[model samples]
Target: DAGVTQSPTHLIKTRGQQVTLRCSPKSGHDTVSWYQQALGQGPQFIFQYYEEEERQRGNFPDRFSGHQFPNYSSELNVNALLLGDSALYLCASSLGLAGDSYNEQFFGPGTRLTVL
Candidate 1:
């Protein structure tokens, strides 16, 4: 089975522009988490979704939002983009809730977003 996949491997946007990145989870996975990775920095958690609801969120501002569908696909939407928003946006899929220690997350190749 295919692992997690993200659309538009790369994206370019200007400040104040909006972008939406898509992700399809691995087979049988039900939860999806989004992260942002800056140059030379580890991925920073953005938010997590399970059962079609956002279960947790990191330090990102309100400009970042997301949604999970019944089929386990997800979309990360960023509004009023800024230069600081330029980063590799990652999508990870797991089998259970965020608190489940036994659940391992499989990450996608990531969508690289560049803000000018």
Candidate 2:
């Protein structure tokens, strides 16, 4: 069973450019969620996708968007990125919304984005 995986491990970008981050969910999971963690801050939920559709969204601006494909993999996109967007982007996966605690989500190693 494969665990969640993220790309590049690290990334560097300018303030006005765009970036794309990738993720693959854990085995036997059908949902994916993205999070942004600033240094010394807890992760802020960006959004979640299930059944190939976005199910819930957080307070992030329109610049943050994502997509989930049929295979349960996902990609997060940030447009017109800002310096504040520099943070550790984490990808989490969970099973469907069953009473199972398995729905509690497991995180990826994260993609660290540095915006200068």
* Winner by lDDT: 1
Looking at candidate 1, the ten consecutive residues that score lowest on lDDT are: 96-105
Cα lDDT tens digits for candidate 2, 22-42? 999999889999999999999
Give all TM-scores, in the order shown: 0.96, 0.95
Candidate 2 TM-score versus the reference: 0.95
Give Cα distance to truth, residue 26, candidate 2, Å: 0.5
Candidate 1 stretches with Cα past 4 Å from truth are 98-100
Over 2-115, each residue of candidate 1 has an lDDT whose tens digit, in order, gives 999999899999999999999999999999999999999999999999999999999999999999999989999999999999999999999986474778899999999999
Judge candidate 1 at residue 65 and give its lDDT: 97
Worst 10 residues of 2 by lDDT: 95-104
